[model samples]
Target: MSVPVNGGDLVVSRLSSAAPSAPTAIALHGITGNGWAWLPVAAGLFGRMSLWAPDLRGRAASRLVGPPYGLGTHADDVIALMDHLELERAVLIGHSMGAWVGSLVAARHPDRVSSLVLVDGGLGTAMPSWVDPDLFMYAVLGPAIQRLGMTFPSPADYLAYWAFHPGLGPTLAGPTGHLVRHYLTRDLVQERGGWRSSCVLDAVRADGSALLDDEEVLTSPQASIGHGIPVSLLWAPRGALNQPMGLYGGAWPPWRPLPEGITAERVPDANHYTVIFDPPAVRQVVSRLLAAAAR
Candidate 1:
């Protein structure tokens, strides 16, 4: 369903079991990902929680969403979506960029977000002040951001690209291949006589810049997050592209002066991409959602 927000309509996918009383949760995807990225999470939470996954602002079906694009606007969009659904409050399950967005919502509009589950993201990386925004995005996102500008000849070619991705390869070749393919196909668009990623670079730049420059995004979750809200940080040891060190390396709290009132855990063997799709990792996420709901 599409609900018009500030700039354009947000396309949200509602997935649930037959039970109408199931707890509801919002699943937020990564920087260039679409709502389908949460399909695996929905499956894992099939009978327990209903999921509302939106093709956040400027990607996939919602790519036409115009300016006022940044994590702050994305937070507003999340609230708008909650209002559109007539939901008073919902748990937020976010990955990568989505995690950061969820953090903002939980901090700024705490009454609207009951709990926050951040997967491999949301925690701001302490980059040097002098580092350029463009370079920071490239350096931080690494191989995952390279496909935004490249054109693909066909859907099969795009599948091939994902098939070889170090972090995503096992996911595409594993039991969740169909779901993975569906998610990837939704991110493709035909234009300029060839197919390319639907993620907008301008939106990416704005969001990335905010991660570095904006105080709202730069603040830790413990600073402004509402009291009694459960914040869970699930980190993958490997990087997004399956590198040895991930965003937080192999440690859960990889920095000094740890934030209080948050639960942190590591999903072993899953990289950033696989953390949502892999069975073990999905179980980890599901368990957290269930815990949040029971709170």
Candidate 2:
């Protein structure tokens, strides 16, 4: 289900087994991901909290929504979703780009965010100004950027493309196969001759540009924490390709560390994408939210 937002309906997946007043958690997915990406976390927390995962504008079901897309717009959209739900305050859980969005929300709408859980994202290191944004994105995101421009004859073709995806495909062979397939295909829209990914390239570019220089949102939380809002970060040990090293390397331009007062933890044996679905990773996320709710 989805609710009306600034530009269009934000598709939301609701998972609830508790009372309506149970501590509510609003989830935000990574840059290329949609609401359904948080299904595992919601499932893990079933019967405990009412979860709402929304597809931010220009991704998945919200692809048609026009731009003005960036971290600020995304933060506003999240607040709008909270308004639609009539929620005064809720825990905000974000993964990757979603984590960045969560930080902005916590900074701008502190009253509406009770706590923050950032999974492998909110603190993505910024690139130097001399580095070309497109080139940097290409180097970091690699084929993920290229796939957004390609087209496929059918959902099967798209699935085939991902058949060898280093982190996602091999993991799809188990009980979670069906769920994985749904996650991959959910954002696809059939076009005139074929199907293309629902993620908007222009929006993605705009977001990447914003992320390159947006330090305030990621760091401002240190000040915001003084207001009694708690923030936690759970990062994977590897990159998107499941590399041994994490995204932020120890190079000259090292990834900026989490600001003071923000708790941080690492998910061992997990990469950028796999962390959300990893069993231990999911447990950590579930435990954090439940503990926050208990307080």
Candidate 3:
């Protein structure tokens, strides 16, 4: 399903439930990810909640969405999606950059959200002064963003490429690999020589810049209204590269004081990618998401 917005129609992937009262959940993927990345989570839901994961505004099927890319714009798109769906309120679930955008949605339109689940993201990174401000995006995203420029000879080749990702490779080879394989396949588009990811490189950069420059988006909602909506931050200890430290480094997002209604909990043995792609981690995320909705 898609919600028509100014730039373009926001594409969404849905896993429906038979139960009439199944709570609706809108999921947002990571910066370089697409809606299908939530496949494992959807499957884990087992029809408990109707889940909809959008391609956001500039990734996958929504790649053609024009400029004005940032968390705020993304949040607006989400709200438009809700309006189109005629859903008065829903549970907001986000991962990585999506989590940041979800935070904005809950803060700006608290009445439209029941609760929020931030998986392995949504916290501000503690960038050091030594790190060049201009290079912070490159520093944080590293190869994940760099992969946009890469090309693979064929769909099979592209599948093999992600099968080798440092942190996600193993998960792509595991139980839910087929689901992730579908997600990766959707990310591919045939070019002259090979297939390249559908994500717009410039959009990714703009999003990274927003996250790096804005502290209030992450801390502001809490700073002001306290977001009355229940929020949970499920973090992973391992980074995107399978490193010991995650996005917040060795320490968590408590570089500053935490907000009143939000709480953080660490997910053991899961990295940035594994936190969703891996089966056990997917189950954990879904359970937490349901719990947040029940709140």
Candidate 4:
């Protein structure tokens, strides 16, 4: 269902179960992702907790919601979503850029966030100074960012386009094919020429810049040991393109090490996108969130 918020109506997917008093988990998708991207998580947590996944402000059905979009706005949008849901507090599960947004929300609206489950994001992805920012983003994100400008004649066409992605393509023919297909088809809508991705390029660029600019939130005293809210990280062992290397070269960030109290786990044999969709990774994520809820 679409609910009106600051910029426009935010599209949300509600996945509920029979569990009484089940905790509500608000899911934030990555930069080019939308509500449906969390389908695997919803399935993984079936009958355990309810999930509310939103399209943010500039992706998929929420594409019409224009800027002043950035990390701050995304966090406010999430808080607005919580208010609409009448949720006093909920677990915030974020992936990639969503993890960054979730961190800000926890910092800005402490009472509303019970805990944080950051999946392959929030701690900050590597951004080398010698490499051009835009080029680097494109290189890391690949088809996720590239498909925004292209058009496809059909959903199959769109899926076919994604078939070339190094990390995504090899898995499409495996047991996880259906999950991969769902990800490719989620935000596609018919255009005058053909079908086009609903992701907003400008909003993505803004959020990307915000991720690079914001370091205070990651290392601030309030977000670390000083804060009461518990934070945990779930990361993929490999890089975005399914490379042998991890995001931080299998090391921690130099700008700020993970705080004393926070716990982190690396999901082996997974990459940026698969960390959310792969069955083993999804199970790990659900287990962690459920564990956090128990706390």
Candidate 5:
């Protein structure tokens, strides 16, 4: 459902198994993705936790607002949503860009977040200075943009396009294909003749520079909050972005070293995307977070 916050509508989807008393886990998806991306993991964990996944502004179903789509703005949006829902404190789980925003929220608004599960991100690493934001956007968001550009002749065609994503290929081949198609088609708009993606590409491009700046800010020591809250960092072992041979050269950022209080876990035999979507992998990370929170 859409809730008005900061002059913009936040699109939030809640998944619960039986009752309202279930522990709530707030999830955040990466760039070019939305709340739907978390459904698989949410379903697995919903038996024990009520999951609330929201599409951030400028993406998916969320309403696009003013400029400065940096970490601070995204974190504030989350806090506003938490207040609207009257959630005193909830576990915050974020992936990729969402992880960065989650870190900012944990650091700035400590009381609102009880614990953090950073899936395949939030190692506090900085991108190199030479990389241009536009180029980075194309590389990172290319697959999603390509899916958006297609004019599917039929529902099957659209499903075919989605099933081919390298990240989802193996998982989408059988029964899981049905699940993936359901979520993808749920967001498609039927125009005069064909299907169109609901995501706003222009709005996503508008804040390209801001995303880069936010990454830099996150890597800075100033963004660090001293050791009190527990943080769980889940890193992808085979992701293109974090691969040893890639641009960053597998080096962790100097400014944002693993804090003394945070626990880090590396997901073996998975890329950035699968680390979150794969059921077993996701459960492993969630188990770690729950265990850490218990301590």
Candidate 6:
């Protein structure tokens, strides 16, 4: 179910087992993603624990708000939702940009976090100087436009458009494609004889600026391991960003080296986007996180 929080909306979905005593886990998706992104992992952990996944502000079902869309603001939204639910602590699982927001929350409000699992993100790396902000905006916003492209004459037309995205895992081409089609058809609204994406494009543009501003958030010292938070970083071995680390001599954003107490694991044969979608690898990372939190 979805819940409203301060400043914007928070899309919350829960999965729990027959037993009521299970621990609770909260999953946060990357940019341009929604709660459904964690559905596969949540399914695997079903009955083992109760899972809550939220589409961060401006993405998916979450409400879009004003700009200066920094990590701190997103972190604040998560905190407010947790407070509303009366959850004192949760094992925070975040992917891509979500991982960075999760880190900020853990740092600023350590009391609210029981543990943290950063999925293929939060490693320190510098922003690419060459990519112009406008160009970056187009590339990042492309997926959303494609998804909400048009009020198709029919739903099949919409489904066909979604099939072309490379980010959806290879295995998802079959069943998941149908699932996405259903979501779009149901979520979109017909206006002026064409379907408009539920999301506000202007909000996306503002949020995009914050996300691509790697220098501000990525270079911040607060994101460093020195904050003394219990953290685990699951990195994708084949990630595009990871490849550059080897070539660039490890100079990256979040500009701090791995902390002494953190556990950093490498997921083999996975890239930035695939690490979250691949079942086996995701399960392994989640299981390891559960084990670590138990300690």
**Candidate of highest TM-score:** 1
| Per-residue lDDT over 74-149 for candidate 3, one digit per residue giving the tens place of the 0 to 100 score | 9899999899989999999889888888888988899999988888788674455465543675565567666788
What does candidate 4's lDDT look like per residue over 1-295, in tens digits? 8777777888888865636588889999998888777777788888889988898898888999867788888888898899988889999989988988888888877788888888888885345546565676787887777888898889998888778888777777776778668766878989799999888878988888766655654553247335688888887877778886666445444234666777888786788878888788888988999998877
Which 10-residue window of candidate 6 scores lowest in summed lDDT? 246-255
Give lDDT tens digits, candidate 5, residues 124-204.
444577878767876865566566566777777777776666665666664344545555665566677887766666556
| TM-score for each candidate, following the candidate numbering | 0.95, 0.92, 0.92, 0.92, 0.83, 0.77
Please give, for residues 1-295, the per-residue lDDT of candidate 2 as tens digits. Answer: 7777767777777855568767999999887878888777777888889999888889888897767788888888888888888999999988888888888888888888889888877775556888777787777766677789899999998988877777666656755566667778987988899998899887887777877877876464664676678888777777777666666542323265657777777676777777877667778878887886766
Better of 2 and 5 by TM-score: 2
- Selected candidate, larger lDDT, 1 vs 4: 1
Candidate achieving the largest lDDT: 1
Model 4: how far is 107 from its true place, Å? 0.5
Worst 10 residues of 2 by lDDT: 248-257
Report the lDDT tens digits of candidate 1 across residue range 1-295: 9988998898999865536787789989998899999888788888878899999988999998977789888988999999998999898988998998988888887778788888988887456779788777777666558888789999899889888888898788788889989999999999877899998889988888877767767674774354567888888998877887887777655553336777888899888898998888988988988898778
Instruction: Show model 2 residue runs off by greater than 4 Å.
Output: 248-256
Question: How many pairs of residues in model 3 come into backbone collision?
Answer: 0
Task: Output candidate 2 Cα RMSD.
Answer: 2.5
lDDT of model 5, residue 200: 61
Model 4, stretches more than 4 Å misplaced? Answer: 18-20, 125-132, 220-225, 251-256
Per-residue lDDT value at 104 in model 2: 85
State residue 287's C-alpha deviation in candidate 4, in Å: 0.6
| Candidate 6 off by > 4 Å | 17-20, 64-69, 126-131, 137-155, 174-190, 212-216, 219-224, 239-260
